[model samples]
Target: MEVLVNNKLYAVQQGITIAALLQFIQLSAHKGIAVAVNNQVVPKTAWDQQQVEPADNITIIRATQGG
Candidate 1:
C-alpha cells in the first residue's frame, strides 16, 4: 500500500493502522503530534482504530517549543 506522509509517498504494508504508521516513520507518540487523514483530523483515541489505505493522504504535525 502507498500512503503520503509529510508530502512524501511511502510504501507500507497492508492493514497498517495509524499508530503503526507513526512508528514506522520513527516518530514518537509522546511528541504531541497531530494527524489528519484525507483532510479530516484523527483524534488520538482513534489512532489504534484508524486503518490507512493506499493513496491515503496523511499529514503529521508536531508541536515545537520556542521562546
Candidate 2:
C-alpha cells in the first residue's frame, strides 16, 4: 500500500501503524513530534493503534531547537 507522508508517497506494508511507519522512517517517538492523518491530528498515545490506510494523507511535524 502507498500512503502520503509529509506530501511524499511512500510504499508501506498493509495495515501499518503510525508508530511502525515512524520507526521505518528512522524516527523515534520522542518529544516534539506531531502526526496527523487526513488533516486530523492524532494523539501520541494513539500512534500505535492508528493504522495507515492506502492513499491516506499523513503529516509528520517535528520541532527544532534552532531559533
**Number of the top-ranking candidate, with lDDT as the measure:** 2
Candidate 2 local lDDT, 1-67, one digit each (tens): 9999998899999999999999998887558999999999999999989899999999999998986
User: Any residue pairs clashing in model 2, and if so which?
Assistant: none
At residue 28, candidate 1 shows an lDDT of 57
Question: lDDT, candidate 2, residue 4?
Answer: 93
Q: Rate the local accuracy (lDDT) of all candidates.
A: 0.92, 0.92
- How many clashing residue pairs appear in each of the predictions shown? 0, 0
- Give lDDT for model 1: 0.92
In TM-score terms, candidate 1 sits at 0.93
For model 1, how does the per-residue alpha-carbon lDDT over 1-67 read when each residue is reduced to its tens digit?
Answer: 8999989999999999999999999985646799999989999989989999999999999998899
The regions of model 1 sitting more than 4 angstroms off are none
